[model samples]
Target: MSAPGEKVTIARKQKKLTQTELGDNVGTSRDIIGKYERDETKPSIEVAAKIADVLDCSLDYLIKDINPEDELAKKIEQLSPINKEYVMAVIEAFEAKEKLQGKR
Candidate 1:
């Protein structure tokens, strides 16, 4: 619980949500959310679950000590070349669609 504050802060920032916004999503007040971020208080299991859902992060990520970016980078690096090409193709298709729409 002591260590979770920093990591939770990081996750919340990455999601670009303010304490008030996050609290709104979890049905809590900004003050309580601030306490969680400051490590002054630990959230109940239910509140934690709601926070995880609102933040689009795993409960483990908010509670346990883990470097989320490291794991994400590793997973991204593991994508196959063919899969990478497919992703690029999708991006190109979207760009083409946008250009076509803009010309209309």
Candidate 2:
């Protein structure tokens, strides 16, 4: 497990949440979250629980130093449509632009 401070910072970043977003959910200022992330301050147990709940992560995972982004990515993938046409369109546009430049 990482030191408590490192764990918190890593969890926050893995959630892709800004300090301001986290603080908004946890009823604190972003500065407080920043301080926690920087190891300049520590949250009480109650605050830690709140943080875990708001971040939608298990306290054990947060404390035990698991990589949270994998779960987050899975959740995002579940929510997002697999739009092959959209992806292919973007790729085709990029190739067309490249060819146009070659012609110049």
TM-score of each: 0.63, 0.54
Q: What lDDT tens digits, residue by residue, belong to model 2 across residues 28-92? A: 98999988877788888788888898777777765565556776556556653566556557768
Clash-forming residue pairs, model 1:
none
Query: lDDT of each structure?
Result: 0.85, 0.77
Question: In candidate 1, what are the lDDT values of residues 1-104, reduced to their tens digit?
Answer: 23787766877899999999999999999999999999999999999999988879889988887776787667767899898777679878999998999953
Best by TM-score: 1
**Candidate 2 C-alpha error for residue 58, in Å:** 2.2
TM-score of 1: 0.63
